[model samples]
Target chain A: MKPIEARTERGRRAPPLPSPGVRFGEGFLDRLGRLALRVRSRRERREGGGEARLLGGGMEFVGFRPYRPGEDLRRLDWNLFARHRRPFVRVSRRESSERWSVLLDRSASMGTGFPGKLQLAAEVVLGLKAAANIEGAEVDLHLMVRGEPHRHRGRGAALAEWMELLESTEARGRGGLARLLAEPGRFKDARALFLVGDLADLQPADIPRLTRSGRDILLVQVLAPEERDPTRLPEATHGDAVRWADPESTGVRTVRLDAHALAEYERGLGARLEAWRAIAAHHRVSFTTVTSDTPFEAVVERVFAR
Target chain B: MSVPQVAAALALGIEWSRPSGLLLLGPAALLLLLARRSARPVERVTATFDLWEDAMRRIPPAPRTRRLPPLPVVFAAVAITCAALALAGPRIVGSDPPRVFTILCDRSPSTSLPLQPGRTRFEVALEACLSELARRAGSTDRVRWRSQDRETLELPVGVKPPASWFARPAAFLPEIEWEREDRPGFLWVTDRVPTPSPSHALVFASGGRGVPGPVASRGGERVVWREGGLRVEPAPGRVVELRGVEAGRLGPLARLLTIWARERGFELRGGQERERALLIEAGRGAGETRELRIAGGSLGWGLAGTGGAGGIAELPEGAQVWRFGEASGGEAPILVAGSPGRVLLAFDGVRSVEGDPALFALAWSRFLDRWVLPAPGVVPLDERRDAGAASWDEWSEDRFEEVPRVGAGRGETTSADLLAPALAGIGVLFATLAILLSGGGISWLRGRLPASRTRT
Candidate 1:
């Protein structure tokens, strides 16, 4: 076969090149946007820790006041009694040395794929540890997994270590909140405690016990979309029989999930959420529900912004 | 005339015989005698004038064409001829009458009448049929008996030794072993003659149930009821009852019963044991079209509450939405784009969710669609015959008739008797019209003044 030579017509012209000015690029705003996040993180550190001021003072005796009825007797200031007629507890510039404890639920229900409840809980714990560590308060992180509770001291780089552990964790079994309550010394010396879980298998006692020590307790409930509504199921080729196995008890129940039953399920799940809300309210512990469908960044922004 | 004589005369094609024609001619002669006695003539005068000088003045008259009145005698003669012809009752075609003797006996349990002097209903019917052949049959004629199983069999015409016979519980089927050089006339014998066609004369003997088939034509050309030994029922009754006779033939009877049941659109299958589960991929809206593919059942497309097009069993447990159309892919749950009239969901083993207030709220969400059933609780039939909603006119042209028999082959007459009567009737009407028209013309001619009269 002979090769054919290609030639352009005399009157034809080449297409003009694209203008450089009109070209799209990662612009200055994009670079500055990165710098802006760094500034925000630095500002967050400055305003975030309530303990920084308390830890900044170098041994100045500030003042004293009479200890309240619920105050720990170990905190009665003997030096303040010499100056005042009544026995008093020391009130110093180094605001009371409060210990921080973070309790996380590691139940199987929290292991949903996106905006994971476990991951959200870990992030909240990290924030609390950063606040406590900068303020000279001791921090402890505890995981309410199916087995025994795992505790880690919130020290230098411990938050990252804890995050790495959480990242590597796999969801298995159930009975999270119950197991956490059963373990002794898990919430030791905690001035304030944060409990994070979907509270699927949680009992009424689980909430009250954490706040019973008079510490300011916050219960952050994390749930997946299925946990919240559970009526939404994907299309399937199989038949009507679906087996729901209880992660902890290994109990299985087969049910027909038609449209009517799905509606009923949603209604009941709503009632359960409301009941949880009411229980937390009565105990005076702050309660909030976090959905797994929300991005983790949005959740962090909302919680930290408040 | 005696019955056989009358049958023979019919076979000979003498419909009116000689006596009937004479009877018609007698009336014609009486009418002729009356017309001759009533005739009378009245005279009229006419004046003639002579043309001469004064005495002969001419009277000029206008020429008038005188028409002659029709002669009634001619009409009388024609009427007489026609009356004789009508009395003669001529058959236009020649056909040899059938010599076949078809005895149809009812072997049903209802036919087990103890009044007959035989061992069984089949035996009684057979004996009666055989005896009829012995009494009235010609030397070359044969005897056909309605077997207990409702089929026909022929017997030897002459005095012969008893042949070996076998009996099934339902009926008897006789097979002849020896072939004689002279074959007797053909015989169609059956118990409860399934039907009486134009071809066979049905001698229905059993008083129990009538024949189980369509009414057969009865005429000299088609059929003649065998008169003396066995009685024949004219028509097959509406309902047919079949009862299994006794212990010996129940197995074969059961098979026959099964065949009948299948004919009535009942199907029997082995029991199914496995339980099935459903996997439904529903879209966002309840009203959105869904494609449901059932594991064991049909794959169909439909709305939630409405019944679907396929053979899918009702939606399975744990299915939030029933799918229809084709299966879909890509992460977002199949978004039912439209709102349906109604939606139903089944929770997979999550009993606690039944009472969940949240699930109900989500189900009623405006974003979701609802599906309405055109008719609720109506289960459609799988087969076309059982589909009660279908109109008769909608039935398939194919297979509408149960047993399609081969019609008359080329050059053969399917029904000469039927066509012959219709053609003869048409010819008679035309002849009547011609006679009336000719009679009218003759009457007009008779009313006119005749130029000359020739007849006496």
Candidate 2:
């Protein structure tokens, strides 16, 4: 499937990506395969399923619990009920038949950074799709472009088709995470939903609403190293003044790089990060920050290993 | 003095000409203040207004102080002062009073004696007079030349003696003016000591050479034969004889004999026909020609013949001759004669005379006065000595101070334009300083402005 063109705040199309193909070299694939194996092992040991907790018929027993009145008799363990003279249900581990839905933010803000947040997020998405395919789960790629969601579904090798489309996508437009995820019908069947973006424009209040749609919501905030600590940016600390331009909105601000102003900026940024952490905790959504400079394998290992 | 009194005195001392330039200072100061408000540095920023506004609200505003801007105020003050000074026409008050000077210059024959080889005492005295006059006498000073107690000539102030005046005959006064009062200081230039005077005066004596003093003699009807000519003493009706040589051969000597005989009232006979009271023989060896050589005669009182070719005489044994004609080997006298009665000529004829006639006449006139003139009861005044001896002790410093100040008229006043270049220079300096100070002050003020964030 072809990726939709991202739009800017002015409703103008952004520049196209440099190339239409993303090459995964043998070494990169080997690293990614090892990371995927680790993720599967860890998930199996912890939950007996791959990144999900869905009920299904399986031979491995999970646990027993008191049977409810309306529960099916087939689930009842008669042998345990005769010994205990109480009705107990037999619970088997669910099969690892899960659907993975990846929501990628194709916003102008993601266009900043060394490897670019969009590029890093695409790599992360590709790694996740590969891991999901390996685990025999169906994967869907949903790209949020210009505040609209476009989805593409595939299984196995077909899941790899979206790599080219993801590579062709340029970072443009503003992504509305909460609004896109609030429509739960499209992603109701998906066991795990991954939202990948810089997340700079997202408000803390939007987190809980976004978490309601997906059974498990993984928020991978793909930020540039400069965005996390602006002082590390080469141009930020040099001159008496620095100008910051927002990629997602028509907003610009210039400030003196004096001690007081730099301290204030750091404080504001810290508060924003803390607020996001609090929101994530409150919503029970898995949250992790990944800098664009991090290696793809490292990100995969860090985000998917549990 | 009190400050206001001093200021008033200064204000009264200066007169102003242009009072309009002071208006510029007001506008300049206002413009400078406005410029300070606008020159603050501006910086561009983005949509962080909410955060920035909050941060700014947290920061307390700086305290306000009531004080003037030092540099600007100083610059303005300097500029205003300079402008005010320039606008006002300034002048100093007062006048220089004029004075009158009177100069009394001595004009005497002895002043002609040479001080140096070429410069006469008269010339030196004249030079000194001119120098003194140029020094102390202004153009309006009065000057008069006095000789023999009379004003020979009056000179305009600052007038130099004519170049020919040095070569001209000496000015002689016939009589003295005794009634004039000496008010202004008198300057006497002479070669002799003058008698004392009661007025304020300064004497400049050129005392290089001494003049001959008056001679005293006791005689009755004496006929003296001195060098150059003969003289008769007390000759009321003297008879003189010229026994040798014809009148035609006598030449200049005949003319001298006629003038002398007329002055002495002598009856002259050409030959020795009557009883001769005196005799003058012109031809060589015609009469007894005594060659008496004088020993150290006074050359100052004698005539020195100039040029070659004139009658020569023999000197007495061991006599020292001052000057003589070439005919006698320049050692003998120019004439040989007796002291009181007889006279003789060494030349064959006076036609051979070729010397200074006036000088020769002066020598003979002096001889006549010594031998023929009667002794008077009183000696004639030596004008140079009288002028030189005139006492200037009365001309003390106090008397000099009393001389009316000449040259400048009374109540004279002058305008001193004190504002042209001096006040203009001060104004320009103040203006330049003001400009520089304003620029620097405005820069500092702009730096002090609050930091701003704006769009690029």
Candidate 3:
């Protein structure tokens, strides 16, 4: 038989494209607008073993009481020490960190839950950008894409432009944070760094690479609730067969979601988080892991512990 | 009724006291349907299965459930049915095999003697026989009573006996037929146990006690004594002769005697009389008008207490004195026994007796029982004065043995009403099964059972 000619209506439109906006209420943006940033860091000396002070240097001079043992000798007010027998330093800066860095993981795993991890990552980015503006720091935006990362340095990209870029961006390929960081000539050092991702394919040794001795590094690990506890998801049943499809790869697994299975998952997830916490502490990096359902303000507070 | 007709009606029969209670089944059926519908298949989808993979490696898969629930619905239905049936009050409707009762009662003069103050020995025996009959009696049973004064009374089991069946004891008991004995249900009730204990008849003796007093009807209508028994109805055989004066001239005495004669069921022929059994005179005897003292034993013979005859009269030769005048001691008589073959009550007005109808009746009763009847009269002797409260065993004969009664045994046809509790137990059993099937109690049972036995 001859191939049938097109008899269907050409006017039938293709399925409409999805909107590119984060799944959050306007109340979150309002809370984000009211926030201000204050970063504290221990500045390590490159030439010596002992750490040096960065808190005493800034644009304006402030009053001081006494000099610390490990502080730089140049920060001491010599005139005040001559008038009084006490040795006092001039504390002029709120924080020495002038530049902030934000690196977002745009991997397929972030796209895998209701109120997706990617959306939370986007909200977390907005929160950091606002804080950096309040602290008058030049922020650099790095997108860990499938083939290569996109870097936006200093204040060259506007706030509107960053949001537009984040909204338009789709999580496509497997680009874990540790593997991206190990690549040569790709990233640069900054006074503070904000890493937003689910920490997939990460190892304990990679935590030091994200930090310099004087760096104020905060790792905001965003996750879908189901990654930590499957019972937290609506799709889970006490004893039902489930089909799971991995977003990045063609791997599919069939599972019976029973109480035993849920218990095993919880135990593994807990141990994983604890390992990450230990490694982060060793590197003196601020670390926080939160689900997509958590408030942005709460996550920031946990990361800085303020 | 035949064995075949009984067999047809008896197979697995049930009758409900409240058939309306079965209406509960409608709602119960609906409930079963609803339970079945609730068993819809459960399906869900989740994000990941990594931990599930680990758990699955250690534990077995969940058991497959059917789209519809069978265990719960079946249990519920059965429980409802049992409850409804229990409420309905089931009773067995099967017929019993035919039974027979052949009862015989003693008609001796002593049988009329009172065992207690109210009932005679014969009455006590009759009551016992009736009770036994009623206990085991069914529609198919047959009963025959060779009663005291009748040939054979066809007593309907489980019903009231006819009034005609209750006949009085004879003055002289005839030779009874106890040799042609009946089978298992044969019963013979008597005042005294007979000699050579019956080979087949179940003999029950009342143990005769007390001198015979006034005999009452089963309904307690008391009557005067007549010879061997109180209220004994004799055959109409007496001829009353009027001598020396016409019955018309005797006036009230003649009329009063006529009424008394009718009341006693005796047809007394007067006026143109033939050779008679009794004689009455208006004119003289030997004594003048004087009250006579009664004999010592006169009271026992049912005379008016303390006093004697109120009038004087002549008595026959070889007279046994019952009453005496003032001068005569116990030797002279106002009343006496007549000749051996023929008897008379010489009721002459010259005896000067007071006009007391009840006394006349008492005197007449004594005269009739002692002189008129064929058998010896039962005098209210002092030997039996307090026999009312004494044990009946006091009068048992040497051969008498009291037989223990197994009430309503063997061929009794009554159906039991124990089905209610059994139905309730069945309901509880169904409820237990339901609980097991639902797995509500499975955790408690888990320790006792193996891992493989658990459903999920």
Q: Rate the local accuracy (lDDT) of all candidates.
A: 0.40, 0.54, 0.56
User: Best to worst by DockQ, what's the order?
Assistant: 3, 2, 1
Task: Decide which is better by DockQ, 1 or 2.
Answer: 2
Q: How does residue B104 of candidate 1 score in lDDT?
A: 41
TM-score for chain B of each model, two decimals: 0.27, 0.31, 0.34
**For every model shown, what is its TM-score relative to the native structure?**
0.29, 0.35, 0.36
Alpha-carbon RMSD of each model: 54.1, 26.3, 22.4
| Candidate 2 deviant stretches above 4 angstroms | A1-27, A47-97, A145-147, A156-159, A176-179, A212-214, A235-239, B1-456
Residues B66-151, candidate 2, lDDT per residue (tens digit)?
22445655666666666665655443322223345455554445565456689766667666666765665445455665544332
Q: Would you list the rank order by TM-score, best first?
A: 3, 2, 1
Query: On residues B167-236, what C-alpha lDDT tens digit does candidate 1 reach at each position?
Result: 3322112332112211222222222332222221323232232212211222111122232223334431
**Native contacts recovered, each model:** 0.00, 0.07, 0.18
What's the DockQ for every one of the candidates?
A: 0.00, 0.03, 0.08
The DockQ assigned to candidate 2 is 0.03
Clashing pairs in 3: B227-B369, B310-B352, B310-B353, B311-B351, B311-B352, B311-B353, B312-B351
| Candidate 3: residue B330 Cα off by (Å) | 99
Predicted complex 3: CAPRI docking category: incorrect
Candidate 2 lDDT tens digits, A158-185 = 5346766776787766564554666767
**Predicted structure with the largest TM-score when compared to the true one:** 3
